[model samples]
Target: MPSIAGTYKHYKNENFDEYFSAVGVPYMGRKMMGLSSPQMDITVDGDQMTIKTSSLMRKVEYTFKLGEEYEEHMPDTVLKCVTKIQNDNEIITESVIPATGEKCGRHYLFTDDECVITLTHDKAKVPAKRYFKRVTS
Candidate 1:
């Protein structure tokens, strides 16, 4: 679970927060609905996680153990997500958003030095990449 915890720490870091906030973060980007441009905020405390978005269109909150499956709703969609380890250093999550039958995949790779999150939506055939620096404990 070190990798999962590391990924959370990376996202909670001050530098990563500043950088992500400065950029106009786009998940699905220009191809999707107008609601796709929401600003994202993630909060993690131990194994619990909550994701908040600025857009009034959609918001989500959930708690799950690592390697467990959970259901959540995003903007105009409902998703079933499973968090699993891709390798010793990566946490990979695949989500199925039920509304449009869209499947999205996310990979979180962690190292002593950095962390990177890559999100790919299979329906649109497009991907978005985001990186974070490890937060020192």
Candidate 2:
């Protein structure tokens, strides 16, 4: 089985201010940062996974079987996601906002010692790319 466990560095240049801000904040009533480049570590075991960014922001942990649907709430956004194996070398996980139904597609590619994830919107517009170097300890 392909394992997805590593620290991933992400870069985002999407127009988040235009769309995310329009949705407004969840409880604080403050807008999210217009741009963010946060690094997160994702650990996947079986069909369960946890993605952590930091102490204050990382608290969500969800589990879902491959080809099954699940709900995920991250900070102020709520999304419905499905995990599937796109091919022998790649896993494709697509997420859609429950409120707006806007789709965000994510593709994870695993090689011998490297992992890459490309994130985009419904229109196939690239919003971010995350690169990870497998570590051994």
Candidate 3:
């Protein structure tokens, strides 16, 4: 498995607004997210990993292990989440709201200098893609 331990800065996105809307993010929140550039830092230590996402408007951090369930506090709702590694350079995360049965997921594909993330909601067939370049400094 590829070690995904680095900082990445967002550069581009595709269909993020629509995906956010489908997941119940308010218009103003979506607008702010669209206008802001976010950075993600990931650290891997054996079977545990920590992921931190930050932007001008919001920031959050999460620590979890592969194939384990954890509580994920999102902007809209809290979800029970699980993560898995798909291949040498890809990781998949699935989250669901127990009270509402709402489901969402993210797929991260890493290259030498960039990571492409895909966001998906169970209610929406179309997914969104975000591109992040590694921060070498």
Candidate 4:
């Protein structure tokens, strides 16, 4: 698998507002998220990984073993999540909210200089894409 342990700063997004709305984020939270530029830092050690996402308005962090289901603490809610790697260069995280039965996913495709994140929710009309540039390798 490709190692994606790096620091990245978000630069652009597409359909994020709609994606957040579909995922049940409130208007104010979505607005603040839209205005904030998020930075994600990924760290991997053996079979475990941690991803820290931070922005001006919010910050979320997850540490889990690869391929193991764990509780993902999101800004709006908590979810049961499983993270896996695909195509050697992509890391995918799928989540389900037990209380509401809501589902969402995040995919991180990484390269030497950039990382592209794709956000998906079953209720969304379209997927959202966030682009990030690597700050540290």
Per-candidate TM vs. native?
Answer: 0.57, 0.61, 0.93, 0.92
Off by over 4 Å in 2: 1-60
Cα lDDT for residue 43, candidate 1: 49
Cα lDDT for residue 10, candidate 3? 96
Give all candidates' CA lDDT scores.
Answer: 0.54, 0.61, 0.87, 0.88
Ranking, lDDT, top scorer first: 4, 3, 2, 1
Error of 2 at 76 (Å): 1.3
How big is the positional error of residue 17 in model 4, measured in Å on the Cα after superposition? 1.1
Clashes of each: 0, 0, 0, 0
> Could you tell me the lDDT of residue 96 within candidate 4?
93
Q: What range of 10 consecutive residues in model 3 has the weakest lDDT sum?
A: 1-10
**Which one wins by lDDT: 3 or 4?**
4
RMSD to truth, every model: 8.0, 4.8, 1.5, 1.6
**Which segments of model 1 are wrong by more than 4 Å?**
1-3, 6-61
Model 4 score (lDDT): 0.88
